[model samples]
Target chain A: MTLILEYPNTQLKECLIEELQLQCTSWRFAVEANNLSPWNRIPEECANYIKDYMTGKGYQFDLDRVSNEAEIYARSVELKGDGKDAWIFDVDETLLSNLPYYAEHGHGLEIFDCMKFDEWVENGIAPAIKSSLKLYEEVLSLGFKVILLTGRSERHRNITTYNLIKVGFHDWDKLILRNPEDLKKTATLYKSQKRDEMIEEGYRILGNSGDQWSDLLGSSISDRSFKLPNPMYYIP
Target chain B: MTLILEYPNTQLKECLIEELQLQCTSWRFAVEANNLSPWNRIPEECANYIKDYMTGKGYQFDLDRVSNEAEIYARSVELKGDGKDAWIFDVDETLLSNLPYYAEHGHGLEIFDCMKFDEWVENGIAPAIKSSLKLYEEVLSLGFKVILLTGRSERHRNITTYNLIKVGFHDWDKLILRNPEDLKKTATLYKSQKRDEMIEEGYRILGNSGDQWSDLLGSSISDRSFKLPNPMYYIP
Candidate 1:
């Protein structure tokens, strides 16, 4: 350890970079585990790391693994044929890919502008997350009704629907979004309340999937809620 | 991508190995997220990865990061000063480091023998995880009560206590272990019941920290639960 402290200038520089990488890796773990919630943006130092992570194969691989497990869980469940067996899916990062927008704008906390995001939504060009699309298709084939619960506002309903369909997400039983009055409520409370209404209507929530913990956490959550990784941001 | 498939033999072998590593990394993400629950062992291909992760700086760095966040969370709360603010910790990987045994035995599915594990526990030489130890001390200084909860059977109580005290863990208000009849229940149910009893007695659980999901999940879990990464094993 003493010898390392005596390292040459070049080695010291290398050590600093490595230290930064390790710190970022740890932050990623905490972010994914929900230990660091109520966070809006990734640490500024981790901007490049987050960009590489989202653009590189790691993000897709993580999604693929989670989706595979979701399929396994779906297969394990003997779905009731009563048409009340529901699978909850969160929109933005869960079913739709906002990667292009995040990619172009960068993740340095500057790109999260509300107006800019709304403009992206209006474009209706968000792609479908391939792994999620596969799970959506499989769960539907297995007789589970898909309920798309999103934090997006009701004003974006037309664009969200068009984009979802254009990007290969279709035949979902319901696309529930926030109403005008839900603007004051948190995503967790809003989604939870929506789920409660669904349960009251006799739907047995078998599986819920989302990139944000708020979507899968809180009251009325399903027994098998799968949290997909989103190291870029956190939603309570 | 197509050109890579036509690479020479040596390059093709490297490609295959890289693919295997990617698969293992994906598995690690799933394991950490608790998406792949009811799992007993890591994937065969991931054994080396797990060994490297647990032994290298990654594991310690993760612990350090989580512990630092735990401290931040602890400092955020103004203590009730009624001795009711309790911090829950799981015994095995949360407080003690079983690294020596896991390292020597090799995590190759063969090291999980019941008798072998019991023998290790009897030694009472397990060291305290430095990161956790720091948090343990800091929380105590911050006036939070430490409650050690474990799934270890009652038979290992004396040695467990010895190991903890020897490793500088003392003044803990309580150490909860499974009873003879509690063996029939899962760790989730058992720990939840204990927390419920604690609540009945007026303790408000402020934080829960564990390496296993079961330690922090279930009915009576805290809102500020920290899941320290343990890619080694999953105990439901």
Candidate 2:
């Protein structure tokens, strides 16, 4: 009878692990789908799971797949010779990955610290996400005027430009940063306003790529938007 | 040296599996995010993976999590007592599980068959996704008018109604279906047009839940939309 009870106990142990994993998978699905929009922090139970996702092949694979899909969409577009067709790309997770910084910050387990994150950004040592860089080059080759639209403050322009250039990003038609006046705006509104201004100026946004839903949503959203996975932190 | 070579060979075998699994994970992420929209059928290589996903704890976990999140969002909305506030629920995978039929099929490994699917739908024996049924009840209790918006045509109305009723769904304000004229329209356009009509009628769409991006997208997309996971199939 004791051995029988032990057998079930062993199964129970395995069940607990499976349950945690399933829960995190569900959490990630919600996060990626923007169902859990404006989420503040990773759940304590999901910490290790999210850490594994960020540090393991999962992160690289997700990035590769998004870039691959974006490339497919980019290739499908019939580019006009007019050169007014534009591709909007978000700066942070979409192009220059902040993994180096996040690696030190518990892979979203820790609450985000803006001052510390800003310091990391100022360092401008972020590396290019390999697949996204490839897609960037492909988009440029496809005759889409590249637009680097970021929520980074205007003060970060010089270092951001240097960082992007050092990481093989170049020849962007415009790198729009947030002005001090735009500080109060949500990233979604800020991006939409910029895109709106671009549309008013006759720049047709063919594709918009970003890790945040805010970057892809709102008025003047592109013809097609590709969302890259970012389980790290929500920016609402 | 031979032993070391054998060790590396074992590691290589593990790596191959890891690669395949990672690819499938990436594929699922893209699918959920709608980056791989209008995908026809599941990849042949992902057949076993997707089958496991659909049949195992993953599917149930996903359903429960989506319903849980939907419940949270539903509870958040302070619906007007006037009964003009509404919630949109997609039928097929949203409230009813086609797992009975899908179990016979290869869990999306096979190409979607309209005739066979129609026959299955006629049976009206589909089970309720328990979590979604609970969500359906919660939405009803929350003082919001429930709208059943589905891609299912008018032909399937009676059977669909029977299936939903058999599964414990009740008190829906409307069950909008596609007419023969609506057949040419994509699910997105058809659903959007319906939602637009409702909007014009002064109905406030507070929440929308669906397993397909088409259900939640387009012009009049709700105040908040929740996406349930359905890696089994993609509908444009």
Candidate 3:
């Protein structure tokens, strides 16, 4: 779906655009927002521009900003933290960069070639997004359990595990992927349900980080949500 | 969003799976049918398979099947037909085949590259889906006012009109594109609103055919709605 700012007032549209530009979910919500017009798709150039930033310092700044906020939240909750306090991280984009795969493909702008992407994942060569890696290391050091949750099918569990370890993400408290039972679940629902399980286990979720809003905006969510820059693709 | 059949009973799951295998929205509704699960992303292979069928005899059969139903309904309603009776046709996939464009891309399985698609559309090389063209001729001859409704942005009107004419769809009473004012509507909402306008203008919609369910499911709808098979992409 596309989102276009169609307000009569150029100033207001610009303002909303600025705000919505910050996150993919924000744009989605804005498109559905009563005040805004319906959107069909993101502009290709804009999507490509985001990809350019992804490998640049500006994109790194965005990640660093999100990771920094996560750090602050993690610290705030640290004093009261028990071993059960958890920080959730989404697998794709949040923790790992698929730039290599998307580089040949049109980032998230092109129709997703699942076979090609899965092959890339199976290669277990996706490196960690530097800032997220830093956050990952910090969260673990601060005594919060790291839970890696992804919408990936369970069939990729082995490769996903290998990729995570290969990229220096080690000893996560739990790694959750879509099992057969979750076939009918939306990423948001599946994620929320999984978080509820963690909550039921008495784990306090302190912070969450993901590229998509679905990963951060559901039931039993963490105290703070940190969204990194990702305009290439969106998870509904 | 993805849809998976995940009922506890293997038989029920299989049954649902079989049904959902037919369309994207089926899986969407099934997921939320009993408040079952939240889903994200369509299956890549299933989407591709649907694309395969679209160019094959299976797709033709589906079109012929829908056309036959339309013809039957039209014949039954022929006695009541008048100059004021209407039949609505959604443009893309309803009357035109985007196979050439999607073939180069990944059908709807890939992220929609609107720029490339629009360029393709501007080429106006999209061939008419033969069955739909036949249905169009049959309906017009039966004394119904034909209304062409599409979710394409209004700016594409010039190319759209040219394409429709070049593809041999002649003399539609009205050709409606999403105007600037319709920027906030869902496809269903936009089409329904247009139908309401037509109703206000004293038109009685007798029949409707579209690949997506949204084209036929909304308000002020026709007496009979015939759906053509399309599982490539979904419009929300």
Candidate 4:
């Protein structure tokens, strides 16, 4: 079972580690034997804690394919015609599921290990949610404009776009990544303003779907807004 | 000839009085001349300023009509059914032209004198703008709802509603007057929040037409936003 607690911060992380050392025999033995202290330098220990927490809970920690498929289907409705209005999708957990990698790494800070991620993308090993991928293909076939909007910093733009193409997201109009300076500010306000600016340039926002509130709240133009389930973790 | 200038504030009163005294030779002066200085003191001068401004700008201004029949005619569009989205009109320039009363009394800080306004409504003296009033009636007859959303305070709701009814605006869901407290905040945020709350309750806003930016900016739910001409004066 995968535990789906709201992702807590460093303070909670320390407490969880201390509690696990005192309780579960398996956890205590594994920690001492491996010299694993998530609270200390070992990042792998933290990943283990997350995995154990999930097993302690009742969930299977499966990636939600149904909801992701529904979103892509709904979004494809706008892409069916000459495609005057375009769709801009987020990357992580949206177009591609990153939970498995995160689960293995134990530390999100290390999840962005570009070399490993690039290799994964090159191999097309990162599985696409079948329904969502089908919907994306439908959108392209219908000729609606498609763009990718990601919170990933601009430095990752080239690799991200290349990876997306390699993974079958083709014929995109643009791939937008965050400016480094903008990432320092509240993420929500930054995305909203960018969306609004796009709308003002005459792109009708038929729909906006994202896991975080910041992605949708700033744009005044969206005809509809959808929130995807993000039970595994949260950013803000 | 009527000599209308922008509504005179205290500082502008002396200059306005001088200009009016020199230019308005055709119409006999009705108000007490001694009270004309410090513009706020002379309600009659203020009224004249509004009237002359309208005339100079080629916008027909009427005072006696309780309803803007002409405006209603020009603005009405047909909807699908008898069920209609109503327009909540503000009384001052939106429905009835208040220039005659303003011209006679000047602009004063006194609360709106509804008894006097009631007499005008009862008289039905103001002729409607043929196009606008026709639009209003067309909208009304087509089963679109007509609402009166005004900046008038709560104290004036009864009289305002009565006056609207007296002027042939008999059917409406509600007359929303601004709360006195709402006047203290940023008009944009206050109006937007209120409109959003109303929309949350399931009202589909087809369009919102108003002369002030405050009125139009307050509601984000409307399908379309229209700004009426307000060339003669301004509120802020």
DockQ of 4: 0.01
Model 3 lDDT tens row, B1-236: 12345335677867666444434322322221111111233466466455655565555655665676677677678545456888999999889989888777665667776798889988978999888999899888888889999988888888888888898898799999988889788887999999999999989888888876568655786766666655566665
**What DockQ does every candidate get?**
0.61, 0.68, 0.01, 0.01
Clashing pairs in 1: none
- Write candidate 1's Cα lDDT for A1-236 as tens digits: 77766678669789888778778877888887877847767788888888877887778899998999999999989987899999999998999988888887776345468798899999999999999999999999999999999999999999999999998888888999899999889898999999999999999999999998899888887989898988876766
Best by lDDT: 2
TM-score for all models, in order of appearance: 0.94, 0.95, 0.44, 0.37
Stretches of candidate 4 above 4 Å error?
A1-83, A106-126, B1-236
- Candidate 1 vs 2: which has more TM-score: 2
Q: lDDT rank, highest first?
A: 2, 1, 3, 4
Ranking according to DockQ, highest score first: 2, 1, 3, 4
lDDT of 4 by residue, A176-215 (tens): 7889777786656767777777777766666554644455
Candidates' interface RMSDs, in order? 1.3, 1.3, 19.4, 40.4
TM-score of 3: 0.44
Task: Please tell me which predicted candidate would have the highest DockQ against the true structure.
Answer: 2
Judge candidate 4 at residue B112 and give its lDDT.
Answer: 47
Least well predicted 10-residue stretch by lDDT in candidate 1 chain A: A103-112
* Counted clashes in each candidate structure: 0, 0, 17, 47
lDDT for each of the candidates? 0.87, 0.91, 0.72, 0.50
